[model samples]
Target: MSRRQLPSEIRKIEVLNRKTGKKVTRYELRMDAGVNQNTGQRQQVKRRYATDREARKALGEIAGGSTDGTFVGRSALTVERACAEFLAGSHSIEPTTRAAYEHALQPLRDRHGDMPVQALSKSDLDRLVNDLVVGTSPGHRRKWVANSINPMLNLISRVLADLVAQGKLTRDGAALVKRLKRSDKELQTFSEADVRKLLKHVENNRLGHAWHLAFSGMRRGEISGLLWSDVDLEDGTVTIRHNRVSVGGQVHNKDPKTETSARTLPLTPALKSALRRAENTQKVERMKLGPDYGPGEHVVVDEAGRPYHPDTLSDFWRELCVAAKVKRIRLH
Candidate 1:
């Protein structure tokens, strides 16, 4: 028998079988891996496999990765490490967003943290989503709706995307797993008459200014995070600079959600009047409570100046709607 020429980037080789003290044939893969940034030198890869099929499979992966400039070679990178790296390297995202990603990825970590990033398949993601939907995943005591579960899938997709960009993954496996079908629910809103009724009821309430802001289209977090300094009674303007949101039961105070979200708006006549009344009322409360008043400068607070969590504001608004005899729509 004579040796034959192997295909490009593949070579026939022989190595001693240490156990049997015999020589056995092996297929070897050799290819350029791209340049090393640190040393500015081209890199190459070489590996031997017991079979030709295995060698071809390994060659295709490396060649495809090199062609697309997304190959980082095989690694021990795990889902847990990738998620942590994504969160750590995410400097531009909001804290709430990062927290949400962490919350969403926790289940993936718990279930498949040890699995390599490249080893994760569409089936694994599908199963993970199924587990969450049925409340079988860790920490999910109740069944989750598609609307809630979809965001988790999106977060996973984002992590996978980051991995792909870093050459740790060839593609985002999460994207292949279709998002659970979300049920269509009619959006809830208040009619003019309902708005008027709530407005009339809140006119005499201590948190009237806060309700006015909500009616003016300010988000609950924007209202809760609004500082007294952000309100300009003389200029008749209010600035949206801060936003307070709760994630995992902890409240976080950060900048507005985006650049456009942090704009200054002219206050309407009714809103201005309500704000003045609120200021005076707060002053009176401060005088009564003296040192007991909350030291925070938040615009929306209780009589003792304690700032309300965004969720607390929503819960209280629902109560107010019931008392106002208006259709109790969410105060979002």
Candidate 2:
């Protein structure tokens, strides 16, 4: 019978020079770190010491720790590697959140892709903050810092926290980064008159369904994902359970952002009338197209029964605002 392989443990130690291998000034120790739970593959950890005696001592400590189940093995994992691992195993993360994390980490990957995670210092983080703040006007920089940099920092902090929980990191590098002071400018909204004007302007337009945003307080994704089945004409209520988000020009159906987001909204008079009209219009179009019409359940759809892309509503609203000579407000 074949001999069973031994469990992972310290495997080798060597004395070596920093410049040339002959003039031994330091020692390198290698240990078998056993199989990775995430990847189901063997892993190894390495450490360096100034002298062979110190290396031996450190190895003995590691062995004792391993024996007592107190060992937290050192990892040479880089930021890129950690991010990759986190994203790969994070199957429960929503698609939109995954996309946001990917976007936030792009700049960091470009700057410190190959740098070891343990080697990252506060100074390196300071440089990242400085780079973002530099080469922009004060007002624009403040807005950009608030909208972009803060979110990136927050994402990095979360990633670092996860690393600490995994025992791969001892500290969160982004914990010290302070959030930038955001401008006190409040979110702008359309007045009652503006809403009336917008509703009248789009009354005959195909995008009349957009009136739900103003009357029902539904988000853009919720509006896009709204289906006829979820609406009760008799009860005048619309149920929000799903959201359609556009990422990379593709539309995806996902759960609402929060538990509160999935709710039943009572339709106001304006919303009820608008939805009724939309239903009638879709029915007429369906009859005209006959078999050519695509079968879809969404309340907001094109002439051929294709659902609108999530971004399409925003673009349509922008054009309608321009044509109607109304102050533009973003579709929520």
Best model number under TM-score = 2
Candidate 1, which segments miss by more than 4 Å at Cα?
Answer: 1-73, 130-138, 141-151, 179-184, 232-236, 248-250, 264-270, 322-328
lDDT agreement of model 2 with the native: 0.77
For model 2, residues 40-61, the per-residue Cα lDDT tens digits are 6655668777755676777787
Worst 10 residues of 2 by lDDT: 4-13
Cα error, residue 150 of model 2, in Å, equals: 3.1
Candidate 1 collision pairs: none
Tens-digit per-residue lDDT, 63-172, candidate 1: 77667665665668888888888888889977677777787777889999999988999999888788888888877767878877788888889889877766567788
lDDT against the true structure, per candidate, is 0.85, 0.77
Q: Which sections of candidate 2 miss by over 4 Å? A: 1-75, 134-143
RMSD to true structure for each model, in Å: 5.3, 8.2
